[model samples]
Target chain A: EADIYQTPRYLVIGTGKKITLECSQTMGHDKMYWYQQDPGMELHLIHYSYGVNSTEKGDLSSESTVSRIRTEHFPLTLESARPSHTSQYLCASSGTYNEQFFGPGTRLTVL
Target chain B: GESVGLHLPTLSVQEGDNSIINCAYSNSASDYFIWYKQESGKGPQFIIDIRSNMDKRQGQRVTVLLNKTVKHLSLQIAATQPGDSAVYFCAESRGFQKLVFGTGTRLLVSP
Candidate 1:
């Protein structure tokens, strides 16, 4: 099994509340990624990091921000969560080969 | 603006039969491809992957076929079981960049 893990598998909050989704991996992978997926839809890359202090925006524009202070941790934070952000947030880590191993995912619901 | 997509939204198969899921990618530059299986309320699990240099790769009871000429990818599962019911996604990446995921195909296996 993959060593990637995500906290708070489910979250529900009101609009405008700030929230942080935690992601961590024990595989010592340098590349970490965050993806947003809706029900019955494909995953869209929102953010990614290539080792410590190296972060980049993904193909999809997202309001959340990510920080990669440590090689194993890549957390995503939403300054002001909106109803539109109600979806599944998946965290993944990959090695040099680019085959990603995903976490269990955090399902967010902005009421 | 390139994208990956699936020809079928859903596929129904009988138990003990073979199942195939197809995907098409618009970017011919993609060099690596992977297949993921996502069960309900869980993260996507890495199933198998095939590099552009290879036309076919097999793992356990799963096989991945890549056809660069038509920009097509496929996953074949032998002896489909009820436990194999899930959403199957195909992802493509060029080099070490972020992956582009195709709209998943839901596999329904019935006894």
Candidate 2:
């Protein structure tokens, strides 16, 4: 399987609560990405990083933010959770010209 | 804007039958493409990949065909099995940068 991992495979939280979704890869890939997917819909790229200290917003507008302080870690945070934020968050890492390896994903439910 | 899309939203196949899923892209600049399989409540899994230079690539049971002239891609599964049921996505990327994912195709392999 892929070396990528995400914490809290499922999460349920009340509105206005702060939450962080964790993602890490042991492959030491320079490229990492975070995608949001709703049921029966396509995956949306929310945030991506080329390397440490390098992060960029994806095509979709998202309230969630991400940080890449370490090469193997990319964490997505929400200032305050909302009901609209309920969805599955996927983490992926890739090497040059190769396919991405994805984590198990975190299913978030904001109450 | 560049984006990827699937021709159909859902595809149902019988066991032992061959299956084909088609995808289209708006960006000719994208030279790399990858196919992913995602089951319910799980993250997407890498299936196959094809670069612009190649027209076809094959894995164990899956084959990806790329038609650069038409900016179209297709995934063919030989002798599809029930375990092959999942949502399939085709993604495109230019120069190993951020990828644009296509609308997903839910594959139902009935036994």
Candidate 3:
């Protein structure tokens, strides 16, 4: 099994609430990424990090922000969540050009 | 932004049969391609990958075929089983960096 993990597998919160989704991996991978996806839709990369203190936005526009202070931890936070942000968030990690290992994912629902 | 598959195409196959799922990508600079499998309410897990220099690679009962000439990729699963039911995705990478993922195909293996 993959070592990657995501917290709050399912979440339902009211509008304008603050939320943080946690992602961590014990594989010691340098590349970490966060993607947002809806049911039966294409995944959109939202954020990625090369290493600690390095984070970049992906091709898609996102309201969530991420921090990579530790190699094993990359967390995403939405200061003010909205209904538009409802989707499944996936965390992935990779080494070199090897395949990416994904977490179980966090399903977020905004009301 | 590059376009991944928008709709999730589905394939139903009988147990013990072989299944093939195809994907077409637009990026010509993509040098690496990978296949991922995702179960319901979970993140995508890597299945196999092939570099642009190679046309095919095998992993256990799974095979990945990359056709750079047509910018198309395909995945074949031999001896399909009910446990193989899940969504499969194709991802392309340029220069071994950022990845562009296809919308994905759902496979259902009947017993």
DockQ values of all predictions: 0.43, 0.40, 0.50
Q: Which is superior by DockQ, 1 or 2? A: 1
Please give the TM-score for the first chain of candidate 1. 0.97
Alpha-carbon runs more than 4 Å astray in model 1: B1-8
**How many clashing residue pairs are found in candidate 2?**
0
Evaluation by lDDT, superior candidate among 1 and 2: 1
Enumerate residue pairs that collide in model 2. Answer: none
Q: Which candidate is the best by DockQ?
A: 3
Clashing pairs in 3: B5-B103
What are the chain A TM-scores of the candidates, in order? 0.97, 0.97, 0.96
Distance (Å) between predicted and true CA of B90, model 2?
0.7
Candidate 2 structure quality by residue, lDDT tens digits, B24-81: 9879999899999999889998888888999999999889999988999999999999
Query: What lDDT score is found at residue B85 in candidate 2?
Result: 91
Considering the two chains of model 1, state its CAPRI-style docking category.
acceptable
Q: Which ten residues in a row have the lowest lDDT in candidate 1 chain A?
A: A36-45
TM-score: which candidate is best? Answer: 2
RMSD of every prediction? 3.3, 3.4, 2.9
Task: List, residue by residue over A14-84, the lDDT tens digit for candidate 3.
Answer: 99999999999999999999999888777888999999999999988998999999999999999999888
My TM-score estimates for the predictions, one after another, are 0.93, 0.93, 0.92
Q: In model 3, which runs have C-alpha deviations exceeding 4 angstroms?
A: B1-5
